[model samples]
Target: MATSIESHVVDITTCAICLEKLNIPKYLPCLHTFCESCLRTYITAIFEKEHKQSIECPVCRTTVTISKEVNTPDEWAKVLPLNFLIVGLLEKEKLRDHKTMHGEELKLFCADHHTPCCSMCVSIHHRRCAKVLSIEDAAMEYAKSDEVKYLKTHLANVDYDVKVIIKDRSSAKENIDKDYKRKQRDLEVIFSDLVAKINDLKVRREAELLKIYNEVKETIDTTLIFFQNKQKNIENEKQIIDAAVNMASNVQVMIEVEKLKKQVEEHKQVIQSKTKEIVNYELLLQDVENITKLAEQMEKACQISCKKPNTYIALSSVTVTPNVSEIFSCCRFGQHTCSWGVKGAKQDAICVSLSKEIELYGLLSYVCKDALATCDVTATVKDDTTDLVVVKDTIDSKVAENNTVKIMFPKPVKLLANKKYHVVVVMKGTSWCYAGGDGETVVDSNGVVFTFNNSPLSNNGTNTNAEQIPGFVFKISDEL
Candidate 1:
């Protein structure tokens, strides 16, 4: 019986300091109970060595204050409050031991008090109370009661709730890690783009400076070579005059002197003309006054934005370009007699209606004649009544083949769902590209539908819709 009772409650009555059953259990402010003698020894050592009026709990390390009135260590330990629960448990243990030694069976139970009682306790304590039953009958009734069923059900619900909370927390942690990596990648891309632009600017400026310097240096070098040649000619003339005076006849010397005089006048005139052409070429660097201001602006470019829970930003998925071979295969817009200039004020355009919100990455246009000038393909949303542009993206033609050309926007354009937008490819001075449309409505591999307009749109006032539609397909990404 003692072993069975101890199995349920031995730790509760044990003292933390002595590691045994509590003796005169005293509790500190932190609710940790300890033996009185153990506390006295611990508190006395603290007061003597450290000369402090407070001690930390052995278990939880909470400070416990000693009252000023309690002068001695023994008094300090004695002044702590007693743990009534521990004392009651100890008393119950003593009672159980007495019952076992004397062989007194507590076979009766008082239902009103809800406790097992010996025969003597029933006659003395529960004599006036009714509703007393044998302990075995009471136990059997409790086992079949609704209270037991409710307890089991409640415990099962609590277990399920605990499991769900743990799983949710784990999932939240994983999402946090993924978001961290994605945001880090975004930050790197932004900085890398800035660095690339700065480096490109630096290279271009350096090349310009070097080109100017080389041109000026070459001009100066040529001028120096011309002066050296004139000096050599004069020296040769002087040597000829010296030889004529020393070895030639008087007539020959006079003729040599006249020729030398004429040559000297010609050389002087050439030198004067060359001096007028000599320029003071000094290289000047136009300083960037806004560089410091740009640096200051760049410092505030990226900001850390924290969003609330359940807020998410989606990323675009890579997708293949749509196939529009059927749309452009039937007829040609600019084939032989008619040509659409790339930079011309007149434009060839295709109007498309989108089914859902999409991010436009690029546009694909068919090319019949080779591109003469760089083309600007623009996508614009207009108000139906006013024809004012809402959103627009214009990108220069980057890659143009004889078959088809791809013009990509520097940044993706976000178009709303269920809206009609026009993509216009403009050209001017020389005509090169040919495209056809109005064949069929085609769906891309990414499930984006491209509904072709019945007629091609043009500012040139030409009605060529019945023959062909503008051949173009929008490059849509999955993310907004």
Candidate 2:
């Protein structure tokens, strides 16, 4: 008995709305596959009518929505064998039609030439053209050839090069990371050094400030104690005077009053001395305070944003110069001569007048051979001049005969404001024959030499003379 042949059941996955086998199926989180378009349209309908825009999966009730752009059939062809299915369907249809006409052979033809061509000729003549061919011919002649094998090998080489490039890029990234770490370490070292220097400077400046403060405080405290003691003594003496005034008629009171007066005088002297000491201490304290304040200001001025090692050292190296006044003066003395008397004794006498004037505050140091030297040196606000001082003396040395002697002064004194002073030297003597006749006796010249601080002055061969002396005029001010 010929039974009816049962057809093979094909399981088809499809979208419900389109009733077409799904070419590009998007699987939702709910585990349902639908055509990308059907999912999008279903979600749009839900959005328009319902307040809730989310759509539920068809198969499962889980909420899911389509992506904005649907994946096309071409994209789906990437992962699935959809193109192979189409080719297989077309092949089956051709075979069925060929079987119906039994007398004529079914000939495979190249679609491009529209004529029957052998499989080898089809592949060689129409290769890479957009033309269709019988499935049997395509499979037998083109797919089985060495050309296909070569293409596969080329693809493999291309993949290998891609992997090499990726490895090299990774190596480069690692090198960059190492270099960054090294630079970070160097910066950290520099930061640490800067911090250390800042701390050192803070400590040094703090010590200096404390030292100055302590010294000034000690002086002020001592002065306060001294003044307190003096005040107590003055009060006790005043009480004695008051008690004596009440007992005037008594003889003992009279004697006590006299003794009290003496005591008062002594107390006055003590008070004066204490007052002077206090004033002096006060002045010294003020000077110390000023210095301390200046140091504070300097610390502020020298503060810097960045810490550097040499900053404090350089600041401390600066030198300060004080204001100074200079003055000079000069004076001259007479000459001397030697003679022989009739008794074969040597006689020597000198007549000398020494005169010198110096600028105010000038200091002088002088030396002479005989007592017969006379000299006067004076200094004034406006000028430095010399006047004569009497001299009677004799110098015995022949080399010293009529030779000059000089008074030398180093580092000329600062001129006092609006003041004048004199430096005088006197000498008197006779020649070797003191009680005898006198011959020609020359007077030795006496002179004064002066120099200003940092000024040019020289001593010539003669002791009585110098090259130059500096002089100055000054006026005192209330501010000084």
Candidate 3:
């Protein structure tokens, strides 16, 4: 049985053509095998002689068709699947042959050289190495070393970490897909709605553009049809005259000639004409330009507005109840002087009269020379006759723009029409706030003057003539 096994191993592994061990073994159609290089030489010689592409088995002489596309034996071998079972048998035979010649295993291991060494190998190569031990003892000793334990632990940790990395990579891909789909959906909603809006406007604008064009086209068609009918009638009359002249006798011709002449004269009479409706191209162009302007305006106007009063109302004149609101505000880049300083508990008064009563919602002022970068102040408007406070506003200094300060009244006060009022402004910070201006003071034709003093004064020119107050810039809404 052992002899048979040995013969069978040699038979299975040996190449028939080479009569030696198969190096890169190749198979033929008849299940016969040969060495790749030897078979390639035989195929090349056949190709040279017969100029045909085929592999002929050396044992069975069975012809196998080689691929026409393959130009060389190396390329042809690559095209075929490797015979892995034959390869495994060859490997087993090789190990068996090794054991037969050199024994089953090495008995010693050279630690310094880090390789298995037989007795002959040690004598030949490992004689200079410092460490050598029995193979079994070397294996046991290295297995218990600290470095080995550390290597094992680290390998286990790396395996666990690699699994986690794969899972996270998969999760990242899923997250990317999820976000991509979500963003696409949001874009679809916004742009699709915008497309719908644009389409609707397109229909409306196109309809407007086409209305005049259709009307003009219809008119031209009507005019062409009328002239065509008239032309056909004239041609029919000419044809009839030609027939009469050909078929009529001389006496009949004499009678028909006068009748034809009279008919021609009658045909010469002018036909009543209808006035053509002409569309003005200039007017049409104007309409188009207006629509283009509207498009540009709405493009910027229809932005996504935030939650604020950038929203506006275009109120009609009739909606305003009969009240005195400010009309004109001509700003005076006036000198920054003539200030009334009412610091601490002290206050200053300035009186200004209006020919028409005004509904006071807000007031404006300028700094006296320079004060704190920001200042706090309070203003009170009082009825001169009634001595009752009409409106009061506290001005907290904020980012001032262009050196002008404005504060809106918490509650708007409608002053009595054509009546004089005393405005007392108290400075909370160490700064003066003017309630009236010098030449900048604007009064109607009713000789309404202005008065200013350091101390709070009563009405009626402060017991004397009123001075033109300064630094008081007033803003109003009613018509002058």
Best-performing candidate as measured by TM-score? 3
- Ten-residue region with minimum lDDT total, candidate 2: 308-317
Alpha carbon deviation, residue 175, candidate 2 (Å): 9.6
Q: Model 2 compared with the native: what TM-score? A: 0.23
Which predicted model would earn the best lDDT?
1
Compute the lDDT of residue 448 as modeled in candidate 1: 58
Give candidate 3 misplaced runs (Cα > 4 Å). 99-107, 118-130, 135-480
Q: lDDT value for candidate 2?
A: 0.34
Question: What is residue 410's positional error in candidate 1, in angstroms?
Answer: 2.5
Q: Provide the overall lDDT of each model, using Cα atoms, as 2-decimal numbers.
A: 0.52, 0.34, 0.47
Q: After best superposition, candidate 1 residue 157: deviation in angstroms?
A: 67
Runs of candidate 1 exceeding 4 Å displacement = 1-344, 367-398, 441-445, 454-457, 461-480
Query: What does candidate 3's lDDT look like per residue over 254-283, in tens digits?
Result: 333334444443333312112112111211
Give the least accurate 10-residue stretch of model 1, judged by summed lDDT: 310-319
The segments of candidate 2 whose C-alpha lies over 4 angstroms from its true place after superposition are: 1-12, 65-139, 158-480
- Model 1, residue 188: displacement in angstroms? 27
Shift of residue 400 alpha carbon in model 2, Å? 99
Better model by lDDT, 1 or 3? 1
